[model samples]
Target: MFHAIPYILSLIAAICAALPVLLLEPSRTQSAGEIRLVHLLVTWNPAITAILLALGLVLAARSFFRLENRAARAALLIPVAVLGLGTYAARVNVFEKMFAPLPDPGFVAAHQADFLSPHDLVLGVSLGDESKAYPVGIVAYHHIVNDRLSDEPFVVTY
Candidate 1:
């Protein structure tokens, strides 16, 4: 029925907006299929969300002008709100906000790094005569480190 089109479109748009967050934001295990789905969704979410929002808005407006029941008109508006939310979600990369890159990382000699145990894993970078070690524990959280060694710039990612 014509009345159901907006509801279906809204539901799909909401899922497209939420699927990436649900799969990525948590520190839980994901199956291979789920990970693949997340990658596909993240890659195409912007286009898919934009098209759905546009279509849903146009259809909802048409239905709103024709519908007689106030309740039905109000229900049709829910799709607009959901599509707006989808647009926002598509624009923002929550993971980037959560795990920002370390821009001004400090370094210390291995002997002075008492926080690291003898067996702690590290990501080591060597540039000419200069060298630095980044603990994997820290790199795992921030995911990227921007540093300079002897006036040369490099980035390390985990």
Candidate 2:
């Protein structure tokens, strides 16, 4: 039972790292309960994951000394790698990485926009003499578009 500490900690750390990302990913359909869980995990993840990884590292180090066989020591590598990956996942904002912002937005004249059907949704913005229409389909994946209109910088989000 005592020897299982590292594996247990690694398993839990992996779950902690993956739970929020899985529930909150943009493409997935999220329910209220799942969103609530993601909120809870986001609040507690850093502290909890740090503690688990630290404890697991210390325990694995101690196990290396107690275990004499070469293969058993090598087996500890799996848990160490798991803990490392979990820590990385917990630290990074994978959603932002996956859904990149539209850096250079293209525009077409309304009359020339043959791609848009009559009923398609769009976000229309007007600044002074400038007018632009962003299709909802494009905005949904990128989430944000940064552009300049009438020489003033602004952002659009969906």
| Per-residue C-alpha lDDT of model 2 across residues 51-117, encoded as one tens digit per residue | 8888989999999899999999989888888998887777787867988877778888889999999
lDDT for model 1, on a 0 to 1 scale?
Answer: 0.88
Top candidate on lDDT is 1
Score candidate 2 by TM-score against the native.
0.70
Inter-residue clash pairs, candidate 1: none
lDDT of each: 0.88, 0.87
Candidate 2 global CA lDDT score: 0.87
Tens digit per residue, CA lDDT, model 1, 1-158: 89778889989999998988888757798899999999999889999999999999999998999999999999887888998889779988887787786767887888899999979998888888988998999999999887788899788889
Candidate 1 ranges with C-alpha deviation above 4 Å: 25-27, 103-124, 132-141, 146-154
Error of 1 at 122 (Å): 8.2
Clashes of 1: 0
